[model samples]
Target chain A: MSSGEIKALVFDVFGTVVDWRTSISRQAAEFGAKHGVTADWDKFADDWRAGYGAGMAKVNSGEDEWKIVDQIHRERLEVILDEYGFPNINDDELTEFNKAWHRLDGWPDATTGLTRLKSKFIISSLSNGNIALLTNMAKYANLPWDAVLSAELAGKYKRHPRAYTKTAELLGLEYDEVMLVAAHNDDLRGAIKAGLKAALVTRPDEFGDAKKPDLEPDPDFNYFAKDFHDLADQLGCD
Target chain B: MSSGEIKALVFDVFGTVVDWRTSISRQAAEFGAKHGVTADWDKFADDWRAGYGAGMAKVNSGEDEWKIVDQIHRERLEVILDEYGFPNINDDELTEFNKAWHRLDGWPDATTGLTRLKSKFIISSLSNGNIALLTNMAKYANLPWDAVLSAELAGKYKRHPRAYTKTAELLGLEYDEVMLVAAHNDDLRGAIKAGLKAALVTRPDEFGDAKKPDLEPDPDFNYFAKDFHDLADQLGCD
Candidate 1:
């Protein structure tokens, strides 16, 4: 498909747009130094992220009450700090440190490609991150979004049909008119399942040697590209 | 109050940031000329807006089911068109005409002043208009909103206390830390009653001689400025 009918591009922000692993690892290293603690910051970033899926699953499965990603991150942070043998950090410092997620730096092509896309179509974040997280990150990273939408608005996490469909509904577009751009095959597949168009943008460095990444698009995906700039060019974004 | 604690400034878009009356009237004039019709487009704009309160009131009072501002505007447009003696316009034409609300022009201080305030505080649109309308308007008017929030998110209309509080909650802020910057006293008061701080930014020409503008802030308002630039100045934005 030419993607001519696509009116909005809703992005998966975490690994697709921002280099979260490097960003988080860098921030965590400074945070560790402040507390006189040392460990593998990269693993710390990964371990913190490991709790994200299970945390959302608990809410999606009705095992726990509804909570924002910030809350989930904070709860997981407490466990990670204890496991890493960190000293007693006060609540204020912990609260400030938790906002490291909001201060992420975008991938090299993110802001420029999004600016080009914005000239032609609406661009927004369709992430599991809550509204506050997305808004703060947009400012911190200079991702110019026309809207900051989240799965939090749908009361579901990514891969949930409602999350994809609800984002389309909120943007006042038909499901197919809002394309989901992500680095993960599963997420693109989920968007296709929800009747939305899907574009697979490869982020080979997303895992940074920690694990293999989804460099190939699924058969059902509408478009496949190496980065956002390639996706923007294929989509005819000037 | 120093206004130093305020983290985000949520705006009332229609009249505060944009001169909707002039924008609608101008668009209506162009539309009327194409249809071989002529009338006081300003009055036509006013007549069209008269349905807004009743439309939102029906939903807020649970008399009618929820509807987006686009639907409400279209419903109101049909009546005004018939009243103005326009010929039977086709569904496609009417649908296109209905988007006039999304094409509003911002007031002179809007873009530049908002850019200034955005440097120091998170700026957002917290309007009764639906997310689609706000998003479209932001792109058209060049309003720099960090988040396009709306009363629709709360499932309530303006003047509803829940609308104010829910906006603050979504921003991950306490009510007192998110100030509502509006030209209308009633909207500012609504935000105040919901435990938010209120800033009254006078828009003296908002009504365009149709009605008196609110040049004076309520005694309880935390700040009053002549325009967004003044508000930015008072708040110590560089």
Candidate 2:
């Protein structure tokens, strides 16, 4: 299938469009310092995010009740804060700190690239994040989204077929007419399995410079680009 | 309640944010000219809209199955086209013409007013218009919406408690924290009945010069203004 057939581009927000690890790490560091604690904040960020997939898996597999990404993050954060040898923090302060995820700065190209992509096709967030989180993040980062769609609406998380398929249906498009754009190979694969086209946009710094990145695309992937700007160009969008 | 307690301002799109009469009449005139027909396009526009509320009522009341606003408009269009003596047109052209609702122009104060309001509160489209219609209209008219929450998502049409309450629920806010900004008194009353604050933003020209407008505000409404700009000023938005 050609890119011309793609009517909408649904994006994965966390590490694909926004540098979550770095953003989370910085905020984690500040919160730690305030509590007179110090630890590998990068590791703290990683540890917090590490539970995301497993948390969603529990819900998708029916082992746990449905909970939004914010709730998932908060549950993991409480455990991590104690692990870091921090003093007890008040619930209000912790709630504010948990919203650090909402304040992430987008990759430099995210805003402009999305603007160009929006000029040609409908662009929206197809994140595991809930609507409130995505809406807050868009304002925080100046992300230009045509609509803020979430797995919360489907009561399931990403990699679950329902999330991707439901988003396409909500946008009034056929599954094949919607393309999932993400930095993760597993996510693209999930979208493909769900009968949606996939584009792998590399974000080498997503996991920080030390770790190897998924720089190469799988054979079945529809498109691979260095970043959102490159993806826009490849898709023939101005 | 004070404006300070209103965390989000949800707009009623059709006659509130957009000048639907003008936009529909303009498009209808062009379609008539193409078909060698002449009629009062304003009356045609009015006739087209007169069915919208009743169409939705049928679904909300379970008298008819669920249908999006676009489908509702198309259903009414068929009846009116016959009355206007429109010659037989192909399905594709009819479908395109039905999208006249999607190409609506925002009121003169819409874009700028919404931008101002966005600085102080979350601004979203809380219309009965389906997600696709609202999304496309936002792009066509340059509406800066943080999210698009529709009655379709709630499986009910406006004036139904589900439509108003569900929108606040989706935005992750309490009913009282979300204010419904609308030109029609009944819609605002529905919102108030659902425990949400109401703002009556009058659009005197919404029905055109011949008819009376909803210029008076209900005594219980939290705020009243002449337009979106006036609403923004009343809300203390920069």
Please name the candidate that would achieve the greatest TM-score relative to the true structure.
Answer: 1
Query: Relative to the unseen true structure, what is the C-alpha lDDT of residue B174 in candidate 2, on a scale of 0 to 100?
Result: 86
Report residue B208 deviation for candidate 2 (angstroms).
1.5
**Residues B74-163, model 2: lDDT tens digits:** 999999999999999989799889999999999999999999999999999999999989998999999999998899889999899999
How do the residues B179-206 of candidate 1 rate in per-residue lDDT, one tens digit apiece? 9999999999999999999999999888
- Candidate 1 residues lying further than 4 Å off, grouped into runs, are A1-4, B1-4
lDDT at residue B226 of model 1 (Cα atoms)? 97
Candidate 1 DockQ, CA atoms? 0.89
RMSD for all candidates, in order, please. Answer: 1.9, 2.2
Model 2 regions more than 4 Å off: A1-4, A209-211, B1-4, B209-211
A-chain TM-score, model 1: 0.97
Q: Which one is best on DockQ?
A: 1
lDDT per residue as tens, model 1, A139-193: 9999999999999999999898999999988888889899999999999999999
Q: Specify the CAPRI tier of model 1.
A: high
Give the Å error, residue B214, model 1: 0.8
User: Of all true interface contacts, what fraction is found in model 1?
Assistant: 0.84
The candidates' DockQ values read 0.89, 0.81
lDDT of each: 0.93, 0.92
